[model samples]
Every structure is written in structure tokens, then in C-alpha cells.
Target chain A: MIVAKDVSLTYQDGTQALKDVNLRIKAGEIIYITGPSGSGKTSLLKLILGMEYPTEGHLRVMGQSMVKDEEDNIRKLRRKIGPVFQEFKLIRGRTAFENIVLGMRFLDFTPKEIIENSYMALERVGLKHKRDSLVDKLSWGESQRVAIARAIARKPSLILADEPTGNLDLDNALNIMDILTSLRDENTTVIITTHATHLIEDKEEGTFIRIQEGRLKMERRGVEAYE
Target chain B: MNKRAYNLAYFLKESKTLFKIDFLSNIFSIISIGLILFILSLVLLGWRVSSYVIQIVEREGEINVYYDLSLQEKDINYLMEDIEKIEGVSSTSLVSQDEAYNRMAEILGKEAGILELFDENPFTPFIEVKIHIEEVDSILDELESMLGIDYIRDNKNIIDRLQNILIILKVLGVLALVAIGVSTLIVVSHIIRQGIYNNRDQINTLELLGAPDIFIGFPFILEGVFLTLLGGVIAFILLKLVLGLGYSKFFTALPFLPLPAEESLLIPIGIFILLLSGLLGIIGSLFGLAKDNEKA
Candidate 1:
């Protein structure tokens, strides 16, 4: 769950990253935050991830205030949430398999259990054969799969993906969407931010909040009818 | 998640990865420390040998007390017994006038030929006194009372000067050891800090992964320790090899080098230095890490 009530952020260099905004998302909900460049999309994701604090108002994620006790609660909240970066952010030194299993290091899984779950996650992303391949050696599409596998490997309740399919072809992008939608079916919350207009066709009856110029546009009812 | 087990496994895995990533750097740091340790060990070996030689020479060069030729044989025997009763007189041998002349003749063989030229023995009767060298200073005033009556002569001034020189040499040796140790630490620390500067990103990543400070800092410390141990062992071996080859030729004349005891103590002393080097390495790495972390 997340709640941002009238939150605003301004950079030190006098740029308004996020305007005063009110937003809420319930547990087990898949939401898409769509906006143009500099529309505060990444800022909103960072605020939600507790990577940055709001300048004006409160922001809460998973029932913990993201601003006041960021250091203490960020790690705890992160344990239950998987964040996939736009650039993948996989460690260059680690192989695809090792990258996928990094999240599980904090968990007390046996070595065998770790191997099994990691293999399963890689298999889900169709990257099991490239398990031992280094991240530097991975093609863009293959690295994207590895990032997704890492995000979901620990069975985190919430997954925040920032342009998860940015570098992928249409077919690979659709497969990524299918994988995310499948996670939603299992009651895992998946939130993604992207400018890819084709995602509207596969909206799947969920909320689509669009923003422009640091302000939210009208919520369209064309996709999935909200309860 | 079980935090304890998780942290343990993470530390083990991270340390392993770190070692693999920067094996060459670690080796370089260790070798730098090792060279410093080797130099320090050489100084110690030299000091030990010097002191041992000084001690031997001092023991052999104690004061000689000559007896009055006018004293009767019974009186000279009583005087010898009285001198032996002194606290620092370890042993005193009574040398008759004839024995002194014989000793001088042996020394001045073929050169002076004074013993044959003189009609009577020119040497005075003397007591060959080898005092317990350490206690020689305290009993000097008591022995001076025997001047010109029971003893005709004494060489306390010469013994005093010799002891003073040995003391000065011992102090200089200790000062040299301290200087070498401090300099070794500085040089090793500088090398390790430079290595840390080169691979700072690796350290940052480990910190981000929630590694405890010791886990992050230990490799550099161990690097120092390994180098110190290796250098120390090599130094000990070198010292022994050199000493062994020259034991009979050079060191037999110099009794200051405690032959078996000091030789056996080398390993233990080297181990102590190895531990110290490791500690220095850790400190150096931590200092660099702290500065980098602050900048970050």
C-alpha cells in the first residue's frame, strides 16, 4: 500500500520535480504511471522507494512513513519490495545467476533452496540457460530478463519497475508484460512507469494515471472500470 | 529471515568475491609490508649480535689486582682469601711473580725478549680477578681500600669505561629498533592506503551490502599481516643462514649473540611482528575507508 497526500519536491537547483499531489494505491493493485520526460514520474517512484524525501507533504509506503525514518524503515520495506531500475543496475562483477540471487542473500534460504528458487526465477524469464553469463556479456533484452528475474526472485509482495521494457523489442516487451500480469494474478502488486504508448492496449482493467507538466491529467475510464 | 545466518553467509561470500576481484592489489600491499618487516628484522638481528659480542668482551676484560711483592707468602694467602670474600668477586686466581713473568714472556715472544734480558723477574705478583661483571660498579669503592698494601695496583677505571661504552651501544641499538619499527609502520600504511584508493568502489559496494566494518576492513589488515609474516619468516631464515655459515668464523669471538636462546626466539619475535603488521594494515585501511565514506 502507498499514500502520498499533497506531496511536492523541489531540487536544490530550483527545478520543480513533483508538484503537490495526492495519490493512493491499495494492496495487490497493478498501476501504471504514465508521463512525459520531466513529468515527475521518476520522482514519484523515488519518493515511493524512500530514496528521496518529499519537500512539502507526507508520503507513506507499505504503512511506513518514507520521509521521517527513511534509513531504518527503507531497508525493512525494501525487503518486501523489489525495485527494478530502468538501467537494470545489475552489478557488473556478478553473473546473471548471482545477480538474480542477491535479493535472496538477506533471506535464510539453504544453498540448495537458493539454487532451486533462483533457477525457477531465471526459468520464468527464459534465461535459465544464461544463468552463469556475466551481466556485461548479456544482450540488452537478456539483461532486462535478468533484472525482472532478480526483482521477483525473493517473492517480494510489491514490485516497482521503472521502464522495465525500455530496451526490448515488441515481442519481448509483450512477454515481459505477460510475466508482470501473471504476478498480478498471484496477488503481487506490480507498479510500472513508462512512456511506451502501446501498454494502453494491454491495460487489463487496472488504474492508469497520466501526468503532464507536474500535474495529473484526468483519469480515463477506457481501460479497466475501477471498483 | 534469520539475520545472523544471513549476515554470516553474506560476509563469507563477499570476502571471497572481494579477494577474487582484487587479488593483485592485495598481493602488492602485502609485499610492501613484507619488505618493511624484513628490514626491521635485519636491524633486530644486528642489534642482538652486537649486544652479545659486547657482553662477552666485558666479561673477559675485568679489573686486575696486583699484590705487594714485600708481603710474606702467608700474608699474601690471607689477602687473596679476603679479596675473594668481596660480593662482586666471582673468582680470583693468585698469580705468583714468576707466573706473571712467564705470561709476559709468552706475550712478548721473540719481539721484546725482555724476560731473558732482565736478571730478576720485573712483573709484580697479581690476582687475576674476573668479577661478576654486572655487580662490578657497586663494589669498586670497597676494593680501592686495598691500594699499595694488600694489592700494589688496580685497573677499575678501564673496566668502568668499558662498561659505559657497552651501555651506550645497548641504548643506541634500542633506539635504532624503535625508529625502524615506526618507519616500517608508516611505509606499510602508506602503501596499503594507496591500494585502497585504487579500489574504493569495491569497498563502497561491500558497505552497501550491509557488511560490518570488520568484514569490509579485514582483507587489507590481513594483507599487512601476511606480508609481515612472510617477511619476518624470510628475515629469520636469512639471519639463521648467515649466522650459521659464520657462526664459527665470526660470531664465536662475539659472545653477545645469545647463540641458541636468541636463535630459537626468532620465530616467536617474528610472529609478534606479523601480528603487529596485520594490526597496522587494518588501521591503514580503516583510515582510508573512513575518509572515502565521508566524501561519499
Candidate 2:
């Protein structure tokens, strides 16, 4: 769970990246965030990830103050949240399987368990065939799939994806969406950012929030409903 | 793998991984260090041997004194006592002219017949005085001022020239050490900095992961220690080889050569060199890693 109350971040040049933001994301709820470029979308994700602190007001993630100086607590919090960046952020020299297993290396997972769970996650993303392939050798869709496998491999409590399907075709986007939506069955919360309207139109796992000019504009829902 | 096996495997794997990255650079660093240290150690040992040899030669070629032929036994005895009282003389003995002629004859062996052509012994009734080597020049001058003595023969000029050569050698030794020390330090620092540059990304990742400072620095320190220790071992072997080669020429039968004594000092000296080399490595690494705080 993440809560931001009147959180504001200002750069040295007096530019406000995030201003007067108040939001709370509950456990096990998938939320889609749609926003334009420079709309504070990545800033919000960074705040929740504890990568940056708000200049003013309180920001809390998983019951710990985001501004606390305890580095151990921050690492522990990060271990619980798996994030997929727009660039994939995979270590280029490593194989796809190695990239997928990287998230679990710091979590005290046994090597055998990492291999097994990594394979299972790769199977879910239809990347099991490319497990041994180098990340640089993979196609864009395959690389995105590898990134998805890496995020889901460790069974983190919260999964954050920034433009998960931005560079993928429709079929690949649908495939990625299916893999992300499957997290709901495991009660894993998901937050995603995208401005690709066609990808999520009339297809929903939970709620949708839209933002423009660094501020949230509306919260809406599609035909899909929670039972 | 089982837990214990897995841990061992992981350690081996990581060590091998790091070794691949560091092995070639570390080897070149070690070899350069070893060659430099070996040459330095050889020079020091050579200088030490040469100094000891020079001291022995100077000791053998001591002052030989001559008195007037007319001086009697009583005069010779009085002169011996006077020479003994000289401040720098360690010991003195009176040699009658006849006795000196006889000794010279024995030295010349069959040529004594030619020396017998003289009606009388031409050798002087001298009091031969051996002075401490350090005070030879001053003592020679003092001996020359004696009123009744005809002449004093001391190899002070040769001794002074040898001493000058030794002084120059000592200066050269200091210069060599300083040059080698400076060059080795620069070479080691460059290698460590290259290592840091190569692993910069991994270091940043470790920092982001909240790794402790020691954990990040431990590997570099170990690298420095390993290279230095290897260099020291090579230098010790080289020193031993050099000593072995010249063992007979310099210290063959000299009782004061201290063969066993020197053997005892070898290990301690080798360890000291290794430790100093390791410290140099760390110094290089510290400078190399200083930039990380700013970049990270």
C-alpha cells in the first residue's frame, strides 16, 4: 500500500515535478494510470519506489515513512515491489534467464528455487524457449516479455510497470496484458502507466486514473467489474 | 546442490568470475613489481658485499712504519711505546731492521740471494702501527709528525679513494630505491584505477543495493594484497639466487660472513617487503576508489 498526502517535489531550478498530490493505492487492486509526457507519472512511480523523496508532506509505502534514513527498510521495501521500466533495464551481458532471476537473488531464494521459479515465470510470458538467449539478442517483444517474466518471477506484493506495452504490436500487447492481468489471481497489486489509448480501451482489470500537466484529472472504470 | 555445497560452489564461481576479470592485470602488476624489487634487492646485496670486501682489504693493507737504522733496541722499544700511546692506534709492534730484512727475504724466497748483495740490512727499525680504519687518515698524519722516525708508509690515499667509491655507491643505492619506489607506486596506482574503471558499473549497482562500504572495498584490498605478496616471494627468490651465485667469491671462508645469521633475517625481510607492497596497493586503491563517492 502507498499513500501520498499533499506531496510535492521541486527541482533546483524551481520546476515542480509533482504538486499537491494526494493519493492512496490499496493492496491487491490493479490501477491503470494514463498520462501525457512530463505529467508526473514516472515521478509518482519513483516516489512509491522510494527512489526519491517529496520535498514537502508525508509519503508512506507499506507502513514505513518513505523519507526514513533506514536503508535496510528501503531495500526490504524494494524487495517486495517489482518494477518494470520502459527500457526493460535488463543487464545487457546477462542471459534472459539470468535477468529474470536477478530480482530473487537478494531475496534469500535458494539457487535451485530461483532456477525453477525463473523457468515457471518465463513459461508464463511465453519466453521459456528463449531462457538461455542473451538479452541483447532478443527481439523487442521478446525483451519486453523477459522484463515481464523478471517482474513476476519473485512473486512480489506490488508490481509496477511503466508503459509495459508501448513498443509492442497488438498481439504482443495482448499477450503482455494477459500476463499482467493474471497477477490478480495471486492477489498481487499492479500499477501501470501508459498513454497508448488503444491498448487499454474497453479492457480493464480494475480502476483507471488519468493525469495531465502533473496533476490527476479523473478516475474512471470500464465494463470489467470486481466480483 | 545442498546448502553447504551450494555455498562452496557460489564462492568458487564468484572467485573464478572475479579472477577472470583481474588475473591478467594483476599478473602484469605483480611481474613488474617483482622485477623492480628483485633488481633493487640485488643492488643492495651487492653493495653490502662490496662494502664488506673493501673493509677487509683496507684492514689487510695497514700502516708499515720505518725508523732510522742507527736507532738501538732501547730507542725502538721507546718508539713502540710511543706509537701504542697514539690515540687511534689499536696495536703497535717494533721490528728491528735485521728482522724486517729477514721477513722480506722470506717473502722473496729464492730472490733473497740478490738482496744479500748488500753488505747490511737496508730495512729500518720501524714500529708498525695498525690504526682503526675510520681514523686511519688522522692517525697517519699524526704518525708522520714523529721527530725521530725516518718515514711512515700507510695506504691512506688508496683507502680514501675506496671510501669515496663506497660513498658514491651508497648515494646511488638511495637514488635507485627512490626511483624504483616512485615508479612502482605510479604503476600500481594506475593498475588499481584501471580495475576500478572496469568494474564501475558493478560498483554502482552494489551501492544502489545498499551494500556496506567494506563489502565493496574488500575485493580491491584483497587484490592489492595478493599482487604484493606474489611480488615479494619472487623478489626473495631472486635475492637468494644472487647470494648463492656470489657466495663463494665474497664470503667463501670468512668467519664473520654471518651465513646462518643472514638466513634468519631473510624471512622477516621478505615479509616486510610483502607488507609494504600490499600497503602500496591499498594506497593506490584508495585513490582509485575516492572518485566513487562523487559519481555514485
Evaluate all candidate structures by whole-model CA lDDT and list the values in order.
Answer: 0.69, 0.73
Q: Tell me, what's the RMSD of every candidate?
A: 5.8, 7.5
Error of 2 at A160 (Å): 1.9
Q: What would the per-residue lDDT of candidate 2 be over residues B1-296, giving only the tens digit for each residue?
A: 66545544443444345546778877888898898877777666555655766777676656888787677778878877887787778888777668988888876655578897888777766677878777777777777887668888887776677678778878887887788777777766566566667767655444443344555565665565566667877888877776666564555534444343355445554665667677766775565566544454
| After superposition, candidate 1 runs with Cα above 4 Å error | A63-77, A185-187, A216-227, B1-28, B46-64, B68-73, B87-135, B147-249, B253-262
- Candidate 2 deviant stretches above 4 angstroms: A68-72, A218-227, B2-28, B32-256, B261-291
**DockQ score of each predicted structure, in the order shown:** 0.23, 0.19
Q: Is the docking of candidate 2 incorrect, acceptable, medium or high quality?
A: incorrect
- Summing lDDT over every window of 10 consecutive residues in candidate 2 chain B, give the lowest-scoring window: B253-262
Chain B TM-score in each of the candidates: 0.63, 0.69
Clashing pairs in 1: A205-A224, B52-B256, B52-B257, B53-B256
TM-score of each: 0.76, 0.65
